[model samples]
Target: MNILTELAQIGNRLDPKGAISFPIYHSSTFAHPGFGESTGFDYSRTNNPTRQVLEDAIARLEEGTKGFAFSSGMGAITTILTLFSHGDHIIVTEDLYGGTYRILEEVFNRFGLQVSFADTSNLEAIEKEILPHTKAIFTETPTNPMMKIADLHGIARLCQKHGLLDIVDNTFLTPYLQKPLLCGADIVVHSGTKYLGGHNDIISGLVVVKGEKLATRFGRLQNSLGATLGPQDSWLMIRGLKTLALRMKAQEENALQIAQWLLNHPKVTEVYYPGLKNHPSHATQLNQAKGFGAMLSFRVKDSSLIPRILKSLEIISYAESLGGVESLITYPATQTHADIPLEVRARLGIDDCLLRLSVGIEAAEDLIRDLESALR
Candidate 1:
C-alpha cells in the first residue's frame, strides 16, 4: 500500500487500540515486577509508553531504527553536540539557524570545544577546513532564511572518509519531504515544534539515529540533560503528525505558487525557493526530497518596505516561528536571526529586506492576493 493509505490504517488502529490519541502516562514512576526487576520503564525521567509510541511513529516515518523526542529544538541540538567532548572539533554550515549558531559560539566554546563555520556548499571550502581534531560535520539544507542548500551526499561521503559523524537538521522539510538518513547522513534531527506539530500550540524536538551505538549515547544524554518531551506534548505531536502527508502536500503547493508569483513581481529582488528552476539546489532537491517544501523567502527592493507590507497584509501573521497550518511570515534579520552578530548576518546574506514565509494549507489565489496588496 502507498504511504497515505498506510498512514490512514495506522491512525485507525491507534484510535481503536484503547484510544484515538495516545494517553499521557501521568505516573512519574512505573511499578517494578519485583526486586531487581523492571517494567521496561522504571521512571518517567528515563522513559514512558506514550513517548515511546510517538518516538516509534517518528522513527517509522524517518525510516530510521530509533527516534527520540526532546523538550525543544535546542534541547535536541544541545544533546547532539554533547556527543562530542572537549578538545574535539566540528565543522558547521556558516548559515545555521541563529539559535544554534549562538549556542555553539557562546556556550559550547566556553567548555573547550572547537568549531569552524565554513560554506559547505563549495566542497573545496569543506576540504580546506577539515582538521585532525574535527569530530563531526553539522549541516542544514535550505538553511534558515537564506535557503542555501547543502550537498548532503557529498558531505556524507567526506564524513565517512574522515571518520567523522554527519548530523543534519531536517526541520524545514520534515520527514514527509526529506529523509537525510537515506542520503548517507549518520543522524537526523527535527524541531517537532514546527511541521511535525503543524499547529502553533506545542513545542518539541526529535532526534533519530541510524545505529544502536549513537542511539545508546543519545539516550544517555537525554536522561542526563532531562530534556525529554512530556507525555502530553508527545501525544499532541503524534496527533498533529496523523495529517502530516496531507498538510505537507497542500503547503508545498501553496509555497510553489506563491514563489512563482513573487518571481515576476517588480519590487521583489530575489526569491529563494528550491522549487524554482533557477534555484541552485533544484536538481539536488528533486533527487532527495519528495516535494519542494513549504518554506520560501524573498527580498523586497527596499528594507523599509517590509514594515509597510507586513502592516498591509490581511492574512499571514508576522510571527517568529514557522510551519503551521496557517500561513506565517517574518523578517529574519530582525526576528529569528537578530541574535547573530552583524558581520555574520551580512556574510550569510540574511539582509533586512528578506522576508521568510511559511506557506500554509491556504487557498493559493487568496495568498497571492494578500501578497499583491502588500507589495503594492
Candidate 2:
C-alpha cells in the first residue's frame, strides 16, 4: 500500500463502528470481563484504545515490530536511553539537537553514561570513535539545523558487525521520507509534535523497535516511566498524521524554491539543503530517502543582516520549534545550539549569521516575497 494511503487509514482498522474518526477512550482503566481474562487495553499508561491505534499506525508505517508513544519528544528519548547501563558509551552525531546534548551531558552523564560526538556523515569517523564500551550509535541524519546526512545503511551494517544497536532519530524526514528501520536500524524515533503531528498544537514522541525482545523491554520501560501520551493528544496526533503526506510534499516544494532563492541572493553566503545539487549529502539522500525534506539552513554575509531579516519577515514566524504547517525561522547560535559551548558551536559552523528555516505548506511565491522583504 502507498504510504499516503497508510497515513490516511490510521484509525480505520481499530474503529469497528466505521466511524470516520477514531474513538478516544477517556477512561484511564478498562473494566475486565473476568479475573483471568481481560481486554488487550488495561490502562492508559500501558496502553489505551485511542493510543493503540496511533502506535500501531506508526509501527506499520515505519516497518517495525512495535511502536510506543510518549508525552513529549524528550520523554521518548529519555526512555530509550534507559535501555543502556551506567557504564555504556554511546556514539552520537557531532551536530545534534541541543536538548539531546543537554540530556546526555547534564542528566545522563551524572549517572555514568558516556558519550562521544562524531561526524556521523562520515561512517569512518563514527567507527573510529567507537570504544569497547560503545553500546549504540544515535544519529540524526540531515542533522538538526546543519542538514548533514549520514549513510544509514552503512551505519546499520557497521552496527551489526560490532553487535551494537543502530538508533536513528527520524524526526526530520519522518517515515514519509525515510524509514530507518527498513534501512536495518534497530530502533527509530520521532518527535511527532513536528512533522507527524503536522500542526504545532500538540507535543508528542514516537518510537518503533525492530525485534520482539527489544519491544518487550521497551514496553516495560515505557510503562514504568509513565510519560505516555494522553488519549486526547493521541487523537490529535492521528488527525495531524492523516494530512502529513499532503503537508510534506507541499512543504518540500516550498522549501526547494526558497533554498534556490537563497542560493542566488548576494547577502546569503551559503545554503544547506539536500535538494540543492551542491549539498554534500545530495546523492546519498537521493539514494536512501523518498525526498530531500523541507528543512534547510543558510548563512548570511554579515551578522548585522540577522536581526533585520528576522524582524522584517511578515509571514514566517520567528520560533523555536520546526516541522509545522507554518514556516518557522530559528537562530541556532542563540536558540537551538545555544546550550553547546561557543567554541563547539563555532567549530560546527553554527555562527551568528546562520539561520535554520522550517519550510511549511504555504504558497512558494508568498514565502519568497516574505524572504525578499526580510532581506531588504
Model 1 lDDT per residue over 252-297, tens place = 9999999999999999999999999999889888888887788999
Give the lDDT of residue 246 in candidate 2.
96
Superposed by TM-score, candidate 2 places the C-alpha of residue 339 at a distance from the truth, in angstroms, of 0.9
lDDT tens digits, residues 1-376, model 2? 9999998888985688888899988999988889978888787888899999999999999999999999999999999999999999999998999999999999999999999999999999999988999999999988988999999999999999999999999999999999999898999999999999988999999999999999999999999999999999999999999999999999999999999999999889999999999988899998899998899999999999999899999999999899999999999999988999999999999999999999998899999999999998
| For model 1, the run of ten residues with the poorest summed lDDT | 7-16
Best by lDDT: 2
State the TM-score for model 1: 0.97
Error of 2 at 169 (Å): 0.5
For residue 334, model 2's alpha carbon misses the true position, in angstroms, by: 1.0
